[model samples]
Target: MCRLLVMFVMFLIPAWALGAPIEIAGRATVVDGDTLAVNQKRVRLWGIDAPESAQQCADPHGKPWPCGRRAANALDAWLQGRTVRCVQRDVDRYGRSVAECLVQGDSVNAWMVRSGWAVAYREYATAYVGAEQLARTGKRNLWQGAFQMPADYRRAQRAMQGEDTRAARVPPPGCRIKGNISSAGARIFHLPGQRDYEQTRIQLHNGERWFCSAEEATAAGWRAAKR
Candidate 1:
C-alpha cells in the first residue's frame, strides 16, 4: 500500500476496501487434503482443514489408521483426471492463495467436509458449518470414530516433539531449518537466512526428522519458527 493510502485508511477512512475474488482455472496437483497447486500458485482450500499427511488417529474401535493419509488419498480420488477452478479469497501467511475450489462443478472444500474426510475450520469461516453438521450426524469420517481435530492434532504433536528435545530436526543435506524446542512445547522449524538459524543446533534424539521443504514439514505437523 502507498504511504498515503495507509494513512488514509488509518485516520481518514472509516472502511477498508476488499479485493474482488480472483478466479484460477487449470489442472492442479494435490498438495495435501486441504491445499492445491494450480498454475504455479499454491491454493489452500477455504473453510476446511484436513489431517496432515503423517498424522495418525484412532478409529471408533480404538484401532490406529493413517487418517491424514486417507484424507489426501480421498482428495486425490476426487480430483483424478479432473480440472480445477478456484476463486481466490486471500493470501495466507506463507503467501499461498486461499480459495474456494470447484472440481467438475462440485465444491471441493465442502465435499471434503461433508464426506467426513475433513472438518470445518471455524477459526477461519463458518460457511461450511451445515456440511460439517451433516457429516457429524451421519457419523462421517473423523466423526465415524474419535479423533483429534486437525489443528489440535498439529499442536499436540509439535508439543510432544518439543518436550522430547532428544532428536534433531534434520533438514535435507543442505536444509538450514533449525528444529528447536520452544518454551511452549512446540517443535519449531527455523528456516535458513533467519537470524537464529545458525545458533540453533540439532539433537539426534529429539525425534528430529529431515524435511525437503516447508510444505513437507507442515504436512508432517511441524510449524515454522517465528522471526
Candidate 2:
C-alpha cells in the first residue's frame, strides 16, 4: 500500500517539476536588460549578463553615463509588446529560471549580447561568444563606452555594502521608504509595515536610498516589493 501511494504522488507531479525541460510562452514584462517576467515567473536570460539598474559607465571622453538603466530601457523598447517564449536550461540560486528566450523567433539572449547591452556570461555558456565579438567590433551601445563587466560591478557593490545588513541608520522624518538592493541586483523599495520592510537595510553608499513616496521610488528606478 505504501508503494502504491508513492507511485500515485509521483504520477501527480508535473514533468517540469520532476526536472524535465520547461518552456514558458506569454507576453513578458521586462525586469531589466537581461531579466523578464513571463506569467509572473522571473526568467534570467541564459548566457548573458546586463548591468545593474543603478550602475554607471564611462563614455569615450570619460563622463559617467547611466548605462544600466539605458540597457533596460533599450531592451524594453526592443520587445515592443511582443510575446516572449523562454525555454528553461537551468535554475539559478534565486529560483529564477535561467532560459534561452525568443521574441518574434529571434534569440533574445543573442540580441542582448550582440547589441552590446549585455556581455556573454561565459562562466555558464559560450554560445553567445560570437555575438559578443560582433558587438565589440561594431562598437554597439555599451561597446561605445568603457564599462565594467556586469558581474564585476555586482561583486564590487557587494564588497562595499559589507556583511552587516542591520538597519542602524534611521530614516528622515516623513521619509521612511526603504530602498534595498536584492542579492539578484534588483532595486526594490519597501513601504512601512510591508513585508520585509522591517528587515530591509539601506546601504546609502551602495546606491540604496530613502524615498518619500512610492512615486519617488519608481521615478528613481526602484520597483516596489511584491510582498
Candidate 3:
C-alpha cells in the first residue's frame, strides 16, 4: 500500500493544512533533484527546486554537460543510508505534498541550496535565501557553471515537446496544435505565440497526437496553457 504511491509537489501551505502538519519519516526513494518518496508518499521539498535530470548546462565556455543529472546525484548521495523525515507544509497543483525535509536533524532543503545542488524557490518562500546566497558566492555544485534556471528549463522542455507535431516549416496537414504530456501526466495543448509553440516538438512515438483547433483540443480532452 505505502509502496505503490508516487508524487511530485511544490510549496506554501493554505491555512487549513498548517496546524498539526503531517509528519512522515522513512527510507527514501529519489524521484528527481528535489523530490523524494518517503513512506511511499511523494514529498517535494518546500521552497527549493533542482534541475531536471535530463537537462544539460554549460560552463562559461561553450560546452554542455549533464548538470541536471549532477543535481540528482548530489541529492542521492546526501540521502544515502539515511533516514529522512518531512513535515507536510502544503499541497501543490499536482497533488504532491510540499514539505520541509531533514536528514538526522539537518535541513535537507537548506543543505541542497547551500551546497548548490538546488536553488531557492523564491516563488514559494524566503527561508532558504541565505543558503542560496552562500551557494552562489561559493560557486558550489550547480553554482559553479552556467545552467538554466529550473523553471526556465521546464518551460523550454514543454515548448520543445510542442514542436514535434510536424518538425517542418509547416505542421502536418491540419494538426497545428501541439499536445504534450507534462511531467505530471497532464495533457496540454500549445498554439502559435504560446510559450511552447516554437520549441515543442511533437512525439508521435509517445502517443502524443495533434489537434487543429482550440475547440477540437478541448473536445479531445486537452486544456490550454495558463502561461
Candidate 4:
C-alpha cells in the first residue's frame, strides 16, 4: 500500500507541473486598456480592460476627458523600467497572448481592477470577479463617475469603424465621438472653421462625421494629434 501511494503521488506532481512557468523580460509599450507590447509581442493582460485613449467617461467633476490615459500612466509607472514576469494562459482573437503579469511580485492585472483603472473582463475568466466588484463599490479610478461598460465601449468602437452592421445602421448624431480613420476610397467632410481641427484629424478619419462645433467635437471625444 505504501509503494502504491508513492507512485500515485509522483504522477500527480507531474500533472500539476504540466504547464511550467515561463519568464519573459521586456520593456512595456501600452496599447490600450488591456494590451501591451513586450519585445514586439502583443500581450493582453488577463481579467481587465482599461479604457482606450479615445474612450471618454466623466470624471468626479462630471466633466469628460480621455480617461484611458490615467490607466496607461499607472501601468507605465508600475512597470516602466522594470522587467515583468508573464504567466501565459491563452491567445486572444487579436492574436495577443493573454496572461497575468507580475511586477515586483504584484499582479498587474489585479492591480488595475482593484484601483478602478479597468473593469474585470469576466467573459474570458472569472478569476478576479471579487476584485472587480470591490473596485466598483469603492468607486475608484475610472469608477468615480458615470462610465460605460468596457464591453460596450469596445462595441461602440467597432460600430464607429463600420465593423458592426447594427451599429453602422444607426447614425451617431449627438453621441460623443471617439477615434476615426481615413484612407483611400473614403471621403470625410468637416467644416473648415471647426476649433477641434486637430482633434477632428485624429477622431474623424476619412469617412465619419461630427455634427457639432470643434469645441463640441473636442468635448465629444476627439483628441489633439500627438506631435
Across 84-107, the per-residue lDDT of candidate 3 in tens digits comes to 889888889888999999888999
lDDT of each residue in 1-227, candidate 2, tens digit only: 99999999999999887987899999989999999999999999999999999999988888999999999999999998799999999999999999999988899999999999999999999999999999999989898879999999999888765543433376777899999988889999999999899888888767788889999999999999999
How would you encode candidate 1's per-residue C-alpha lDDT over 1-227 as one tens digit per residue? 69989787667533224344578889888888899889898999999999999888788898989998999889989899588999988779999889999988899999999999999999999999999999999998778888889999899988877755533544457655556666676877878788787777776565555556788778777898777
C-alpha lDDT values of all predictions = 0.83, 0.91, 0.84, 0.71
How far out, in Å, is residue 15 in model 3? 13
Better of 3 and 4 by lDDT: 3
For lDDT, candidate 1 versus 2, the one ahead is 2
Error of 2 at 135 (Å): 0.3
lDDT of 4 by residue, 1-227 (tens): 99999888877785326676555557777777678788888889987778887778897889996777777877777676687778778778877788998888899899888888888887888888888889889988788888888789878887767644434344366643333544543333344444554455433333455444446656655553332
Best by TM-score: 2
Which parts of model 3 have CA positions greater than 4 angstroms off? Answer: 1-18, 166-227
Runs of candidate 1 exceeding 4 Å displacement: 1-18, 166-227
lDDT of 3 at 15: 39
Clashing pairs in 2: none
Among all windows of 10 consecutive residues in model 4, the one with the lowest summed lDDT is 185-194
Each model's RMSD to truth, in Å? 13.6, 11.5, 13.9, 11.0
RMSD of 3: 13.9
